[model samples]
Target chain A: MSSTTQIPFVDYLILDDPPYLQAQECKSCGARYFDRRNACANCFANNFQPVAVQSEGVVTSFSIIQMGPNPYVSAIVDCGGTNVKCTIMKVEPTPDHVTLGMRVKLMTYSMGEDNEGTEAVAFGFEPI
Target chain B: MGTDAIWIIGSNMTKFGKHPDKDVVDLAAEASRDALQDADISLSEVGVLGVGNLMNASAGIGQQLQKQIGQTGIPVFNVSNACATGATALRVAIMAVKAGETDVGMAVGVEKLAGAGLLGQRGPKPEAETWQPNGRFGALSSTEGRIGTSIMPGVFAQVGMEYGHKYGGASFELFAKISEKNHAHSTLNPLAAYQKRFTLEEIMNDVMIAYPNTRPMCSGNCDGAAAMIVVSDEKMKSMPSEVQSRAVKVSASVLTSDPYEDGCQILPDVNTLTKNAASQAYEQAGVGPEDLDLVELHDCFATAELVHYDNLMLCEEGGAVDFFQSGAPWRDGTKPVNVSGGLQSKGHPIAATGIANIHEIVMHLRGEAGDRQIEGARVGLAHVIGLGSACGIHILEKVA
Candidate 1:
């Protein structure tokens, strides 16, 4: 048996212990963003602090994408005040199964493994 | 600004469809030549040249155009601004003349996108369905599949759905109906990519692209080119009576980008910037939406057109659905829209779309449009929006 080491797919995603997303919150406007930035897009302040994003969120908008390799649900989730774009995993990709204002929580799953037995983990939101 | 107005003396475009025999520069040169002939102007008289191209930006299309059309030693500016590249190119020429850099300037926009599939369709995996990671952790996987979508159809699909959720309307059939109208309009436009009309049933039952948007509802990806020649008021006075008689006045030319907005960065906001541009254009032209006789908007998707009706202020606030349901955008309706079949059938050649839209408007305003002409069309508006968040609007008036 081979032991696999897990790694976060993006810099904003944390893999240690409980996986959660981290955002660069503006010190001036209190705006949160997942990507790294030199200044806040809202107030244009150069200072930003990395803050942990809430795992639970409500679906604000979604689309059932069929153009992909397989049918999947692409959605924007409103976590408290911040909005996150993610796929709704572990649910049927249907209008009845997925809907607006649906409650979901962030979860990590293995995408695939490499020659070194290192697993790349990606995050998605699942029904809570 | 005193009668120091700018006028589009000549405008022309190649039939928007497959041009297997011609290349990009060939199409650009043809359109430029035709436009110059229409203007009764010679290449030696053109003071500046602005070329718009997206897929072939690094090629220095402006310099290449000069080689084919005549080398007048004029300032050449090659611009690329997503779908708005063409409009941006024309803007460059207008600005040159406005700044007293040149009196007569030429702007050309060309693109060869025939057989180009969906805008953001992803390619094959790294290793034939098998992953062989080599990085410190592993091969970096994209956020597209795991997170929300990045494709144009999906983005617009969500945007349309959001509009429905907010205001309560905009059904799937409604969006399909919008596509049907555009397809029907294409039947009269010989230059359109697909001239055959599709019924509402056919459109609704067509292959699904995202959700509400079917295959027929999307813009046609085809090859085409359009060119325009602009002259200042001072130069227009010196032109012949016949040459000045057909010139169309450029009342307003406005371009805008995305402003900082919350929860909209991931999915580009197509409405805000468009609304901003439309208002600015109307203000600059000293007119309102009621004054528009016809409009050629960026209908990259049927769903997009609905939101833009409101964004363009063609209708009342939160009344896009009502505007369509009222049949005001039809060819014979009160406010004719996309009389040239829009991008849906006119074909979206990217860089060419901007100038092509203006070309359609100019043709109608001059009462030169053949079968697809809007009768008594005097004031027209041309709009094109690019995904990287750029919106360009030009309001044209027939010089009396």
Candidate 2:
């Protein structure tokens, strides 16, 4: 195995083996958020707990973005009752391929490496 | 019959488009001077001033304007509330007049955004290749570019798509057709940034900034300013008969923000706040949707126009598609909307939009809007919603 150490691009993304995402669940309202929150956006409760998010999800909404340097699919995936915004990967960015109700699973890919060979990994959802 | 009622005696707006030679203050002073002229009053007689600007909110634009338009040493309020800045400024003047603090007040909104392209990514700038830790979001970048998009066009596009997904009837073609209507309406607006008409095919075939929103469908960012002069009912009766006859009554002025709800927090909830504001405005005005003769809403995007049709209660719930298909929003239709070609073609100069909308309505109420005038328009509504989640609604009525 290569000696490059992997770093998750975001705090909520776990870079361990069989990597998955985590959410901050509000104890009062059960509202889940990817980033750390001081208060629940729904209930305004300060209490929270970290919970593992389901790896698999279904696409609820998507848009084939053509404005950027390259065309890509930007989507909202419903993963085990939690809505997660993500980019769909490992598939063509077209209406026929990436569509609503499509099933997808969490995956990580390297964004780039720093001077000391620390790889910054970003997360996306791919067709399961 | 209420003596506390506020009236708008004069309103004016500069032609919305590029003004390379003039700065923000220059544009603001011109609008302010013209509004005072329309009111047949002098700046020396103005009691208070409220200036709205988003791009340069901190520069004391109100004071700068006073320097050019004869400083009255009145209480100057520099206001900023995103796209609703103009209306907020107008509200300031109205409140002052109603509170008896000032018999006459003026509000001005100005912006210089010509040639400023697509809403760029906001927040920490990512390096050319490698990722770096940033403020607030930490190592995570702004959610704008990554997951879906936070850009105005992209967010509004997704909002429209989600609406379509929930309710049938919204199609790519339907959205394009909505754009065609606005572009066609622009042809009659001499001061609109772009007064060109486009066919549905041309709009759909043009470059797509975001799905369902083409270049022609999105609001053009440009330079412009709008100003208004307000006075109390007591003050209005003292004015000349011609000025009193031309004045428009402020039926309602309401502003609202998003209420907490269960949904994707990433996408903005443009519906609830708008509905709340509209409900409160109608109640205050003692008028319902059918009573309005014309409306100038924030059509920042064509998709936005469709959704706002429902938000503003211009149609039955889940009936925007039917309303559009009925050809009711046309200039000649029952409920004429965006008669100034809307933001889609009239141009959206952020701060100027709110008062600019009010200007359109006031002009129609006074029977001064040439060419695109809504016949015998007695009551009109001007609505604008900003994404920091503020929605402002104003109802105006012509004096019979």
**Candidate 2 versus the native: TM-score?**
0.94
Docking class of 1: medium
Candidate 1's residue-wise lDDT over B1-400, tens digit each?
3337999998999999999999999999999999999999998889999999998899999999889888878889999999999999999999888888889999999999998887775674554233443332233654566778888888888888778766878788999989989999999988889987999999988888877788898898899999999999999888998989999999999999988788767667898999999999999999899999999999999989999999999999899999999999999998888989988888999999999999999999888999988988899999999987899999999975
lDDT of 2 at B297: 93
Highest-scoring model, lDDT: 1
When summed lDDT is taken over every stretch of 10 residues in candidate 1 chain B, the lowest stretch is B128-137
lDDT of each: 0.88, 0.86
Model 2 residue runs over 4 Å out of place are B1-3, B123-131, B140-144
Model 1, residue B168: distance off in Å is: 2.0
How well is each residue in A1-128 modelled by candidate 1, as lDDT tens digits?
55467766777788867999888888899887777576887898978888888999988777788874698988888888788888899999877788777899999998777666767788899999
TM-score, B chain, candidate 1? 0.96
What's the residue-level lDDT of B70 in candidate 2? Answer: 87
Interface RMSD computed for candidate 1 is what? 3.9
Model 2 residue B359 distance off true place after TM-score fit, in angstroms? 0.8
What is the C-alpha DockQ of each candidate? 0.49, 0.50
Could you tell me how far off, in angstroms, the CA of residue B101 lies in candidate 1 after the best superposition?
Answer: 0.7
